[model samples]
Target: MARTSTKRLIAQARRALAEGNRSYALMLLREAHDGAPKDGAAAVLLARVLLVQDHPMAAIEMLAAHLARNPRSAEAARKLSDILASVTPVTFSRVDAAGLAAALRLDRVTADPLARAAGLLLAERGEAPAFTRGTDESALLIALLEAAPVREPGLELWLTARRRTALESLAGPAAEQDEALLAAMARQTWLNEGVWPVAEAERKAVDRLDPADPAHCRAAALYLPAERWCPGRDGGSDGMPKALAGLAGDIRRERHEMARADADLGPDISAADGTGDAVAAQYEANPYPRWGWVQPPLAGAVRAFLDRIAGGSGGPQPDGGWAGGPLRILIAGCGTGRQAVEAALAYAPNARLLAFDFSRASLRYAAMKARRHRLDAIRFRQADILDLPDFEPPFDRPVDLIECIGVLHHMADPFAGWRILLDRLRPGGLMYVGLYSASARRGLTALRERIAGERLAGAGIDPADTGAIREIRARLLARPEDDFERALAESADFYTLSEVRDLLFHAHERPLTLEAIGAFLEGEGLDFLHMDVRPHIAEPFAASVEGGHGESAVLDLKAWAAFERDNPDTFDGMYLFWVRKPG
Candidate 1:
């Protein structure tokens, strides 16, 4: 079990692999991994060998066991995560959740099993009640809630029923006193913007309670912090029970801090009347996609990432300041600062980034996140995309890269905004753009039309009304599982107030087809270097092309368009691709 022996075994395994002796490599790697169970490198090597030998299940089990021992092993975790993500409908047992949490993006994990379990429990018990302590469902739900927003509609409905039961119990002496359950509810409601509908009777019961009462504040925590039931109770938490008051205080502190951050956001490029103002107002009210956690980036040079993605497709090479000094990056509409922080950290000590958006609330959220990450180099400013054409940066020179993802399609003129962003990019520099595909989002488009036509016919629903949004959500959720509109329930956005608004009730949205995108690229005279498609789409499309996975096939716009026509949902997320400006 000596460290030297493990290293020697690993070195021998590598030599065997290089010599075309896979069996020897596998045997040596297994011995090395068994000797040093916590050694991530040895476990990763063993797993790779297992995979190459057509033993995928063995590879997964080995990685899982390695993660259980050394949960912080990035090498083992990455390999496990890649395998898990490549396959669909991954079922995690109750025992597996805690061990896999370190490797998997738990928020994105399928909640269908949890929903089915809860449903079976409800059917047996006659109703959904307060989660009893020490139950499997309770522990699993709490872990998922804490990790990320739970996106499953069935789980949301089950929780809503349970929340109502807990609220009703608050009116009696033997109230819902489970602190862990209360905390989990608070986190879920806060993340979802209190999208759960409250029955009028339950609302009236909560209305009759005193705001100063400890139980009232506890019940109110299950709703959004801004709701009427919890108003003016800040600092009033003093002299109350510690567990009850702490949750309330935490919510108030977050809102207060966000307000302070809003005041501190530098620069102002606020636009008056038109599509820009309406869109700005929508985001200002509820910052889209309230993010909690950010994944740390692996540090590397900016050009290294470009080369990996570009694969030397042969375009004009970037020149000027980027070649020798800090790579300048402009992240237009960097909502909540997740993208900005990732970019800034990924190219640390070698990149200067400016991230801006029109909504002060969003910019404020992003700035606070950047500060939390200790990223001082990012210039977080408030600016509308329309105003960026006239805006000047503190640093001179066009940026080496411009990233405008999921932003331009909402504008009155997406092309004009794209043109403005392109002008800011240095010649031969790269641009990454993500635009909505009209073909891919046909179902969502129909749903949006239905909501506008049926729900908001004459009076028009206010985007900020939680009650109205909840009603609409309930109606959608009531649909059959096979219903096309019911598919919205599967989206993470459906669980959150702000995201649902952005997705289904946006003031302005225009989805484009690939044909239009190809034409725009032609007119703009930019080289289409790469389309960031996942392997499932990329592999099939590349095989269909004449050159078959060559540089020409990857860059073939017409082929890509035809592929999209055949497989419409290829870009359901967006048409995220990279292009280079002519030198």
Candidate 2:
């Protein structure tokens, strides 16, 4: 075959592969191989194609041929080694026995199969295996003895019995050995195979240690699952500590109830008023009131969005690259100030950051973290996002970024709040706004509201009391069938994907479609640079014919007819939009 033909065929195969036509690419590679039987390049391409198709053995054979021809090909050798390590079980052999022994002696090959095999091979070569001071040579040897099938029957039987006897002996007098080794062995067993029995045995041995022994508690804690310490209240089973056992069942029950109440539409029965509608009332009664933010995921999403925009070419230009000076940033509804502090530390190390939230308690917690880390750049303030008393732009040279994630959905008029934010953005500045998507969450909202009302009416206890809260949570959990209905009812409000579009872009009464969103950006002095649907909004649920769904089709449809008419772009569920003012 001509060299030019081989090159053309390889290029064609690469293009097909890039386009995800793997089968077609493989056919081309096979044809090329037929034409150029001894061509090393053809063999290499065939090997790569086979590897992608998961025929590792075929890849190995092809790569081996290629390597034979090109002995100096480190890339080919590395690829061959990786495939071999992944597929072929590492076995002890005389060829590399000394190297393995040295690694084992240094404790570098502990627990890994290839390393263990090498060590065993070295030991078998009549060389005294060098044992590291704190290394577990006995355990390594026992594992290798078990893995390698002995050709000599008598020798095999003796080795097998010795391995078992070694484990038994070490396990029998567990109190005499280091607690760390016992815990490590237990962890290894658990990782290799979910052998809870081994872990349980190890835990029992550690528990037998005297209370005064420092290692005793550490060993027990190491063996204990994290869930045992902080078990989620929702139906998860984890044994609690004796000191916390009394509260465990109650906490679990409370968690169950809270989950249900969170799902329902009614007021939380645990609140001072005994209504499950605290969230609804909090927003509905005072959309602009001081609100408390929780959950770092919510805050982090907003921060990421703003950072993306601010750093982009179309948005505000940084004064001196990212490190030239700190960019002034504000996190509205910055609960606990985690996102705010993170932003200060990440983007504008020298830049001033003001983290404002309505809850004094949350701010206090944020302050504690800031002080602990000795971060002097962040300033935590307790203030309402809706009615800012003295918020001026250009703290240094205009607020470069503003993050408002879940806050907009809670407001009575989110657009009003959005406009207020837009006015605050410095020219070429970026604002990250998240609101609920209507297309996805309307049905949920309706159901949640209905369930919350019923629960609140039935439960006569004060919402603020622990008992009342417990009762409310219990009621919600009792009817697991209506969990979604309850959640929608309790949450402040949800927007559909289309609703988010209309709220952010369209001022007209009629909602805009995908086409309209793009067109509107051109019409208004604003530019819709990018938009991202919230990740949680895409959660799959059972499909229904009632038009109500959890996933947003509006956002999913990337290209659609532009809105010819002035329509409202109303929807239910949360969405993030990055819009910019022309510089």
Candidate 3:
């Protein structure tokens, strides 16, 4: 076949595969392979189609034949190895072992044969007995060891004894030559022990062994006593003691905070202002607050914003027929309860509001705020957002109003969590949620992440320790000139506006958009009453119009959008929407 014909056949096969015509694709690929038996690309494609069609043994056979003709072909070698590694035992046991032996004989089997053997062993253990020999013997042995049932006393004891002897031998004189092997042995032993403290101690001891000696570094890092040995820094291991102490302190502080009552609010309003003596006293009394972000002004602003959102100015108005009864609002992820307290005071004057957060220290502070205001309508609970069993049953009626701002974006699965919240809403209930928007700030975040990675690598900062965090924070807060550069470089799991739209509206089947409030009311049998663009900033401007302008112009646009989107009740910073279900 001509080169042009082969290319055309390959293109057609790819198009068929993309269009979900797998059988047609396989036919085209087979023709292409038949025309050019020596063509590595055609062989690889045929192998891929065979695998997709649930014929792993066939795929392996095709790849092996291609590699036999072109021994130096890296692509063919790679494809063949991958197919072998992934083949099921049912398929692998049926494979011509003699052919595989020939391939191994051609060159040293440096690639991971253990993974391949494991897959094969999973389907047929009878063929595994023959695998424990030759230069590639260890791979087969390890695979059989892993595949052997743990509950089988005979096999378990045999593998355990074999593993122990192998590890002990590695600990001998020649262990230095294969540090990775020695480390792997140590990790396996530690995992078998099932004791964290013992494992940690062993890891520490290993780190103290010797860096010039790779075996020690690997063993220490992988198992108990895994601390880096610094010969001159101190008689002790390098930075491990300090790191351990910091972790212990964090755990202890959290426990202490959880045990304390929420009566920290003093009669003196000055002390409650979160400044000067108050801040010092609070820190001394409760240490958990020291670990996280804290800005008194920002907290106050968040509270004020929540109040505006709940005041019925930008939210749905209660029907006169329903009477202004006690409204039940729930605030999920109510960190510090600042916004929760603000909502209670601003909107639910005669209603009951429940606010919950994961951090005991934050809940305590929020409880203090509620007490300070003498507000009886608000209640605070410390609870995980994902596991909200406590709030589910007693509050069986869907929440009348729920506010979750700057919370969903942090969750590992934002869309899933958002769906859970939506399920908890009353038929005519209102909800407000916020997420980090991808824009100028996202660019800054990526830059910061890169800088952090570089600093961690350069300083040899332990990834598990607070040292990296401290180093990054110091560089970020260094000078005005350094701040912008550092901020821009950092990366985080933030979403762009388009990503948010697809996630909430498209993927999860939730009704979300810039026009979510109105659309949900109309489509979901609710009332689309009002929307607020931002709640945190004094000035409001669309994200597209916010940057790259004079301060005067920025402020002017912000002022205009404040009224333009939803007048008199608009606040800038976070986008807010409110809708109500009709009774």
Name the lDDT of candidate 2. Answer: 0.45
Q: What is the C-alpha RMSD of each candidate to the true structure, in Å?
A: 4.6, 18.0, 24.1
Error of 3 at 134 (Å): 87
- Write candidate 1's Cα lDDT for 285-394 as tens digits: 87887765444444455556576654354444444233334677899989888789877877667678888888888888888777767788898778777776444564
- Order of quality (TM-score): 1, 2, 3
Residue 15, candidate 2: alpha-carbon lDDT: 97
| Cand. 3 Cα-lDDT | 0.47
Candidate 3 residue lDDT tens string, 107-134: 3232434234332433344434533444
Candidate whose lDDT is highest: 1
Residue-wise lDDT of candidate 2 within 62-121, one digit each (tens)? 555554445444444444444544454233331333222222223111223333233334
What order do you get sorting by lDDT, best first? 1, 3, 2
Candidate 1 colliding pairs, count: 0
User: What lDDT does the true structure give each of the candidates?
Assistant: 0.71, 0.45, 0.47
Superposition-based RMSD of candidate 1 using all C-alpha atoms, in angstroms: 4.6
What's the residue-level lDDT of 266 in candidate 1?
A: 62
